[model samples]
Target: MESAAAQVGCLRRTSLSVSDVEGRHREMIVGDRSTWSFRVHYHSGDEIVHMLAGRAMLRIGQSARRVEAGETVVVPAGVVHRFEALDQLGWGFVSEFVAPGAEGPGPAKTESSLIAGVRAMLEDRYSLRTDVAQIADACAMSKGYLSRRFRQESGISLHDFHMLIALHNAKSMLKGGSSIVEAALDAGFYDQAHLTREFVRTYGFTPGVFRAAWQSAPRLPSLTHH
Candidate 1:
């Protein structure tokens, strides 16, 4: 993993797209005065935007709100929202637009070492099955103990976290032009209908509609880290 300073430096030079943290979900690190001005006219999935640094302004329909560091806002599916930088703000932002569930606070600092190990496992191998027993083993704790502690720290069950990861992957594939059936299989969904049902329920529109809107939009220039 890159050092925080290195990550910041990369952002300062240009906008960078990090590896997806979950399925179609991506985290964008935008540097000072790097402005993003585009309207998200249609939404296929809910988006949870967390401000990791500086400040940002979010416009939803007619109303606008400023979000500062350490704050977060959930943009529900189908809402017309746009984001703009506030001043020469550098921001580390996480955008999860594939899942319908909510995330509580992340794991505590005390569990950083363990969380790192788990993250490594997930990043290194997409085939690794995530279960309470497996995660507990990675943390070197009993299943029951890990379950309770993880819930206390993250405010959600371990299973739910894995589900979020799966959903995120599915969304990314969809956005990349993969068929619904293919994305569903790739994301571990039972079938295309299962994926479609959950996706529509969380995002307020069918997958077909979302895909059409996304494909019709103007493509922004590719952003990369130096």
Candidate 2:
């Protein structure tokens, strides 16, 4: 990789790749960008990118490496990185992603006390009818500050995390033969309709469909909570 920003050009393209494993697939990303810069971010899987043209400033952790045509870079899962295209010719890259393992740890415990306390509270009691404002008040922090800090440190908004907890519990109850309405109430939702909406939005299907499908399939592995 080379770092010559002035010479970089914007590029746009697409690519496709197939996975070797049956029923598994990998997406191919081929693009040329003369003017492109991405914020620092991370992926859940490992990625290998082959530079086809021009150059790019690839930041992995705190180091920036210049990659020119014919070179390749491998980024491991969970490592933060960013890309800056260099040259008017832009740079073309083809990437392949590798899936990472399941059952990773939860958010680090070294964040602020407010964040840790909120996390613990949610883990222990998300099934109760509690909202963000109440949680913030209990933690002696403003609602706005709590929301911002939670997202910045945990990579998920406070509301979404609560929904996730609810959904996890609901799924467990469903597997135990609880009715949708009963599971929804026990999981802190207002009613069956509320549960159906979030369930469909998140899982792309309704709870009834899921239960029927699950009955025909092998039991899923136990869910690991943080």
Candidate 3:
């Protein structure tokens, strides 16, 4: 189990893998792409991507690494996953498995007051930038306390929640054929590059790559945000 990217070494074209996926229960899916990437989304169960050719940057959550021909990237159940083709053409055999009791979007979360306020700011007024200190001061608490409590209650940091909201809306706009600049500005990003940077950081692909992929692929799953 070496680093997949390290093993890839470079984004050069390779022979497509013709090996068959071993299971029958999971539906076999075959596909290829160039200058494209899957939308940032998660499944109810684990997903296995067995690379057939070329290389890709596979992002699970915020970290990404490369997977080349003959490599396999397995995304844990319920984890956000995406990948960008890094070579002329990358294809793969994909099997997504829905595990038992994976129904719904997990258990309900009881929102604490701190989490509620932050959620309101991030989800309700996502277009405006809200300072962490301002939230802290309003609650008569230190920023440190606010952030820690927010994370504990929400299972995510305040900054990430805000970023997710922006990214989510930007994605919606992009899928609707909005230009990158329009999506960025409307989603509260300073510019297209800002959205691209955050998108790559979170989704492992640039906005252009995502748009290209979205045009060809049918609707994919996304987070069930509040």
Total clashing pairs for each candidate: 4, 20, 0
Candidate 2 runs further than 4 Å off: 1-116, 126-129, 219-226
**Which scores higher on TM-score, 1 or 3?**
3
lDDT of 2 by residue, 1-226 (tens): 1123311211113323333322222334555544445544444446688988889999754467999989999876544466787787677777765433344324332446765677578867736555788888897889898888777665556766667667767865775668888888888888887887676555334566544433443332442211
Across 56-110, the per-residue lDDT of candidate 3 in tens digits comes to 8887545679888888877664454567878665544444343223142222233
Candidates in order have lDDT scores of: 0.53, 0.60, 0.58
Candidate 1: tens digits of C-alpha lDDT, residues 1-226: 1235533543354342324333333333333333434323323345677777777788764578998878988876534456777766444465544422244112223345554465455534353256667667767899989877755544445565555555556766766677878877788777777766665444333455444444453343442110
lDDT of 2 at 15: 27
Model 1, total clashes: 4
Q: Pick out the ten consecutive residues of candidate 3 with the lowest summed lDDT.
A: 11-20
The clash tally of candidate 2 reads 20
lDDT of 2 at 120: 73
Inter-residue clash pairs, candidate 1: 23-168, 23-169, 24-168, 24-172
